[model samples]
Target chain A: MYIPTYEDMLAAHERIKPHIRRTEVRTSAYLNELSGAQLFFKCENFQEPGAFKVRGASNAVFGLDDAQAAKGVATHSSGNHASCLSYAAMRRGIPCNVVMPRTAPQAKKDTVRRYGGVITECDPSTSSREATFAEVQAATGGDFVHPYNDPRVIAGQGTCSKEFMEQTDGLDMVVAPIGGGGMISGTCLTLATLAPECQVIAAEPEQADDAYRSFKAGHIIADDAPKTIADGLLVPLKDLTWHFVSGHVTEIYTASEAEIIDAMKIIWKHLRVVMEPSSAVPMACVLKNPEAFRGKRVGIVITGGNVDLDRLPWLAAS
Target chain B: MYIPTYEDMLAAHERIKPHIRRTEVRTSAYLNELSGAQLFFKCENFQEPGAFKVRGASNAVFGLDDAQAAKGVATHSSGNHASCLSYAAMRRGIPCNVVMPRTAPQAKKDTVRRYGGVITECDPSTSSREATFAEVQAATGGDFVHPYNDPRVIAGQGTCSKEFMEQTDGLDMVVAPIGGGGMISGTCLTLATLAPECQVIAAEPEQADDAYRSFKAGHIIADDAPKTIADGLLVPLKDLTWHFVSGHVTEIYTASEAEIIDAMKIIWKHLRVVMEPSSAVPMACVLKNPEAFRGKRVGIVITGGNVDLDRLPWLAAS
Candidate 1:
């Protein structure tokens, strides 16, 4: 399991500063009053490439040696990470080959193409993606940058928590949605080192509650297959991420599909910002479990804002 | 006709600095490449009350004397200004009476109530709204704050341009949607004084072209009733606003409903920000007449983001 030191997180911040946006924090009196918590939303929704993935992608690309970077980078993702990698690689004038599932949203695919990514579509199955990625890597000799299992990627994501801490002092708790656990692990590592008293919580969808079950059972749990509107959080927790989360994370909570949709609606109406269902999980958790967050100075990481307009959850009712 | 001096605009900026957001400026590479113009979008959509109206509303509330402010203020509108006034009044701990037309969206009415505004719903006809507002003002002795005709409101709106100029230097032109000419008039006044070389243009919907007609005829053009998806821009340009616009505004451009809808869709897809049809007029003008703006650094004020989700233009097909 890869563990990132505080120094590594600091270095990642400096490296990705120019490439990634220091997304502003959003606060609402209505939300604060309703939740009974002084909430600070770290709007990674506004980050470059429209997600927090940019931090990790930019760091991985820039952290490479001149010779290694010249060969370019590759990744497999059907979501924001693919676009982030493509955007980061485009910025550095390097080639990026993304192995995306054929079922990926057309909007996401178009965005990847716009960012100059070479898209290789494969079946939705993990085996197909891995097989196609290996073939591409072998042909091009490109560096395969793991989305979250990498120490460098985890360190890069930690910078978000670093910025959050600087923006607002003395957060009693920090909550983020857990997917492959890149963001939550990074968040925990940063808070544990810099603000030892701050508790880090992971919000997971009820349909994909591997992390929540793991936290309860005192073991690293894996969901062989998962389903949720939060497609970004469907991946099972990796060993490296689980190691950081198990030791440092205070708890993991779950939100229902209806709660996630409701949270998304609230964000759209109040914040006037679009967020994917995965990004709304933290808000959903807080809304559902208000007692745990009451009177706390809480920080919620809004992970991404790459929702497809055609597939908006609100449209389903119509 | 009351004209706001440049000093008034500067003072308004300082007074409302703490209350209103100095909204971020977003530049679109795709927009620039498509139009052959360097465009800077002054994102007033992200304002506290979800529109540029907050600047004017806050200024009106705070600029008043304590004794006068205690009496509170009143206005009649069916859109952004009503919500802005309510939000501003709530912040100042003053009573707010909004005489909204019965035709106003329930979302807007709910928002007004959420911000502690006393809502007095009236028929959409002029006689009914005026009578309702008169009764409210008579009963409460609150000052009648005209949506855009008052000097303080114009000065407050001018602050948007002041910030825009400071955020991006040497813009060749600035364009904003015209309703009662409040925004454009204020914007023109600021640019005329500070950046005299900059051309100020007004973008109005073809369906509600009172501002365009007024500019061409060199007289106030009154439309008893107008139809446009840009509900906020339905009102005819007022005499006070016409005076400022006629003297400082270089030109008035009109956009068709299709153009406005297209612009809104683009903003939703690329910018990930929701904009009402009124706010999209200026953007539509730029998109429709690219030749007029080629190679110029242009600033476009996105005036509001308070679109009713159920009535969003994109929902037509969905």
Candidate 2:
């Protein structure tokens, strides 16, 4: 139940500096005109590991003591977090064990292995994933780094906002896509202290709108299996992430699958950055509710850019 | 007879500062490992016009005197230059006349028109384009700005290299894809005075290796038409570009169609930048001749990102 402080975020930024990129902040006049908001995109897609997850992964891997580091880290992620944690561990000359569903894409598995992560397959169920990850951690004496629920990981993610705030002049509101709520939670934790005036907005895919429902219900709402084209955002928020989201976030918005893909195309066309569908959720929401963001300085986080080049959504739809 | 001077490039840089974007320089760790070169990418694809041609187009449009500007600027280009010149003219609140091939892609035509460019359609043949352009210029009393041949245009393109040198520590070589050789010539223009120790290398498609052949033959060899997936790199170099290429460029290399697409995929995968196939030639040649670039700092220019999202080359090939 550890709630990370501003000092923790400051420390995480320092700890992860050597291992992660301080990705660029980009602006598009076309997108600004379309949304009627001056949008500043914090391009975490430019991160070395192609996702902002590297920020948290680097912080976790680098913070461990030499003796603890020898045991390395373990996580249950079939997405960018697996690759990012593996990349961070590879950089530190340590082992990283990833517990993923056997049904996960082979491409995802290859990316983790490419970054020196050893994967153990589990049933595509939360209980099975937890069981497998626990076994892997017990056998290797590895530190368990939950994708969003952990204070260290949340603190690491907070550093993205720190950089985002520093890069732009000022933001009236900050927007980030919420899945497990790692990124959104981090945004809240940072702006709560750094720019308290700035409202934190969480965007979720309508198909996977557990966070949106939870915000209205005034409690943690876990979904069994929500589906969306933004595959990375199918997961539910955990206790630690819910703590930040429910308390600090001002509002939650959801976009349809079509809206997400359309927004992805616009960002790719105008911002000229290769980003994921999950990353498009914030922009999709902003475009959906233009009056909420119009004429204001809005900071949008482009969460990741790991997509199969051969399978562009727009190409498939057409 | 109007040869652009290093001082002209300096003046162009100053003049276009308020009009064009000072594009960011990007680096890819994966690309560095793949090519065995410390590669720095000058990302002109991120320009507002989605091409580096904007620099030269802006310089030409902005450098004109009130009388000349009032007459407005005109160009005969069916490529990035047309859209870029139109965008520059729109920025300056002036009329822009473009002489485009009637057979040009509707997307290109639509882009120019979107920016308030007045298009005069001409036959696809060179002679017809020229004749049509001449008539249009006479009708409008517009100042003709050749896409790459003009001294002002060359000087404006040179600003990209000026910023490249300032952004990176010191490149051992600067690489650019050669179609009409505006970008390569611009690199030569800036580096000849700024970093004379650095060599300017030109890359061309095997299908459209006119510049490669011209370099070896020690003369300009204009080709009527050549086909390549890198549609932007099919044009032949003119007298103005040939002047810089013959005087300052150290080597010319050609890459196959497959190689260009492969390099483009690699860039999209690793650099996470949406650039055109024309922009991939430098990296393709670097990979082809790794021995030459190995253990050296190489600067590769990503020329543009105005490709049709639905028609991704790799997707069509597969």
Q: Any runs in candidate 2 off by more than 4 Å, and if so which?
A: none
> In order, how many clashes per candidate?
0, 0
**Candidate 1 pairs with clashing backbones:** none
* Per-residue accuracy of model 1 over B17-118 as CA lDDT, tens digit each: 989998888775667777799999898988867899999999999998999899999999878888999999999999999998888778889999989999
Candidate 2, DockQ score (0 to 1):
0.87
Q: Which ten residues in a row have the lowest lDDT in candidate 2 chain B?
A: B309-318
Which lDDT tens digits does candidate 2 get at residues B1-318? 788999999999999998888888989788788889999999999999899999999999998899989989999999999999999999999999999989999999999998999999999887999899889999998889888888889999999999998999789999999998898888898999999999999999999999998999999887656889999988888988999999999999999999999999899989999999999999999999999999999999999999888888888865
**Candidate 2: residue B173 lDDT (0-100):** 97
lDDT value for model 1: 0.88
Q: What is the lDDT of residue A238 in candidate 2?
A: 87
Question: What DockQ does model 1 achieve?
Answer: 0.51
For residue B114, what is the lDDT in candidate 2? Answer: 86
Which one is best on lDDT?
2
TM-score, cand. 1: 0.96
